[model samples]
Target: MSYSYTIQQHVYSFPDLKSVLAKASPFRTGDALSGLAAESNMERVAAQFVLSEIALKDFLNEAFIPYEEDEVTRLIMDTHDNVAFQEISGFTVGGLRNWLLSHEVDSQKLAKIAKALTPEMVAAVSKLMRNQDLISVAQKCEVITQFRNTIGKKGHLSVRLQPNHPTDDLRGVAASIVDGLLYGSGDAVIGINPVTDSVDIVGDQLKMMDEIRQRFDIPTQICVLCHLTTSLELLDKSPVDLVFQSIGGTEKTNASFGINLSMLQEAYEGTLQLNRGTLGNNLMYFETGQGSSLSANAHWGVDQQTCETRAYAVARHFNPLLVNSVVGFIGPEYLYDGKQITRAGLEDHFCGKLMGLPMGMDVCYTNHAEADQDDMDNLLTLLGVAGCNFIMGVPGSDDVMLNYQSTSFHDALYVRKVLNKKPAPEFETWLHNMGILDDTGNRLTIEPSHRLLKNL
Candidate 1:
């Protein structure tokens, strides 16, 4: 009455084994078996018998463990080169389920290898592993890192132009401003805020690069930063001089964490295709908002670690893939209130653990967010040594830019003579007297030039 054998608590019969084999069959390959030769009943049975015998021998050899005195060894030796049965030898009915679920086996190959595995193995493999999309994630990481590096190193100055300006005129002004600054000593590439003026950010950047190639001959590349919309659009139109997207607002929403990241990935993918040469050679800046909190030092502050974590995760996730540059713009933890913020407080926010490596994502001091002089000083002092490559701000006077540079360089002569004085001497005077300084100067005042710097 009991026509089955029980092994390891499961009943097995000829019919049961056939049903299990049918289930373990390879995933449907659409049309691989359409043209088998038409034959009579006895001929078909004979062909099937030959195939089954060959497969059975292989299955016994691969699926069964070898012993000093074993029939399976003899079977494998007999069916040595049979492709269909080869895989059968590798799996056993009892262990089939476990092997199927293991990393060693792929779901797609199940049916092909079933001859070697028992019904139990096929059932187990089918139930265990799910499809993973790691390849896409890894591609995204590589793209992000490439963009970041391009924008990070070549960028020296940060600019914010009114969105309405004509592209040609804007480029000239940008060129002039940058040329003027270069006349002195610093290699400043303008950083622009694109969110405030989308068109100006995108249009002028393309125009400026075109003009630079046409009008002037600067040996090195000039860089600028733009908002997301402009960046995405410009990435399509021309080579991005440099582009950065602010990650989040003061609040934590799905838009900041999820949507923007998707947008970044999309643009990055497109940029890779559109870019002719190496895209990673340019820098991709990550200009983050002020950390969400009352304290300037908290990584996420009010926004909490969720915001910083997301940001750091993006950088950490991408850094391994990008070949060129990655820079992080970190804002201070507190709102600017004149001289209330301290250097130590600045350090906590500026030097605190945020994400990625310091060299990978350089910090940008943004307490200057309100353009407070003291806050600017605090940011420079605390974050400068911590490997901050850029200072985002508007220059009130040439003196301010000069002061920032002097502080950055820790120029002993300029510090002792100029910043350490009762009334700050004219920047030109300090330059003239200090043999290391250059005499060339620009007539940048607080009205227009300062306005350009303010929005940045």
Candidate 2:
């Protein structure tokens, strides 16, 4: 089917309501009513008008006419409830599109509901708009934002790489390594991590990554850098999956704190540009550190509450640009000084213990879970209930080495067992016979399998 217009670029360059109606169809008030009577039954046409939207919002910009939004909503509901339309056409996609083209839309409600758009939503919507493809430029952003909210469900398995690898090829190498190792076999989004604090380094990495993916035919993308959130320079360089930034450390006096704040500002500014810019999808991945000495007087380390406040502050400031984000919980043991803290403690703080404080942004648990298996289980279960969607850690040994070849399917199966409650039947039988499967045989009280721990 031929379309009247192709949104090859953005959606801003379209006609207005007065111009479109005048140019496309000469339907004045009396004339429109008369025409409706001539073409179809008045009742049917009126009912259809409530269900149909005008063709491509080209008419709105044409004559400087102000369309009242409430009218559009009332029309949508009316059409949806119309017995004739419902009985004749059921709420089909074509029916919805036709309704939207001829009717008005509540822009305010659309904005409120259009919060977290992601990449997957793109394909889904592209299918919806395949023929008409009439999504307004402004509406495209909102749709993408809602899409992000859906696909933003990530797991806590981050891929670590050497940021200061001293070569322009680092990004490509890192991308290939990550794609082969973590992303290749696992079902998680991979964050491209960097050690050095340079945008140029990140840019090179991204470039190399693109080249590697193109050359090797890998269908994967490394969400931008997981480093100190600084500068739009990195975002400006490439379309990213996410923008993971670090909140300054514990001590306010440390030099890293000063640098981190600077990075935070840059990241915030870049995120603003991204949200408003009709480019590809983007996100703000945030975290706070109590690594060594406290770098800031903020808290011992940036707790979830602090993370939520900061995230809200950024989201509020950026408005639409701050696509879905996560408040990373990087406790001391995972960073530099302290030994391993129990995963239960981290979950109580990060994943939340049924309080439901941080409701929106995804919560990413760091590789710190590798410190203990019971804690890993606790963190995983808590994350499941709390609705967190991202996870990070290295494969093979949890170090920054790309070792896909070395990944054990056995270990992968064990993780499946824990995550899906599909414990091996034989093992459960043994545990149950030994009185470990609970009285109902539905709950298995297996000691956190120490076998996996031994391998680690």
Instruction: Pick out the ten consecutive residues of candidate 1 with the lowest summed lDDT.
Output: 134-143
Instruction: Give the Cα lDDT of each candidate.
Output: 0.32, 0.32
| Best candidate (score: TM-score) | 1
Error (Å) of candidate 1 at residue 394 is 3.7
lDDT of 2 by residue, 223-307 (tens): 4454544346566656554555443322232234444334555665666566522233334444432221222333222222222
Give the residue spans of candidate 2 off by over 4 A. 1-172, 175-188, 212-221, 224-231, 235-241, 248-256, 259-282, 289-295, 300-370, 401-456
| lDDT of model 1, residue 156 | 20
User: Per-residue lDDT tens digits of candidate 1, residues 1-456?
Assistant: 112334456444322222222222222111012111212333333322222323233333333223243322233234333475465455433343344335655423533442333222222232121222111111111111232222222112211211122243464445444433332322223343333446555575666554543353322223445555666766656656444554432223324333354566665565556543233433344533323311222222112222222233333222322111111122322323323223222222221121222222222233233334344454344332332333322323222221221122222122223322111123234334423233332222333443223332
TM-score of 2: 0.40
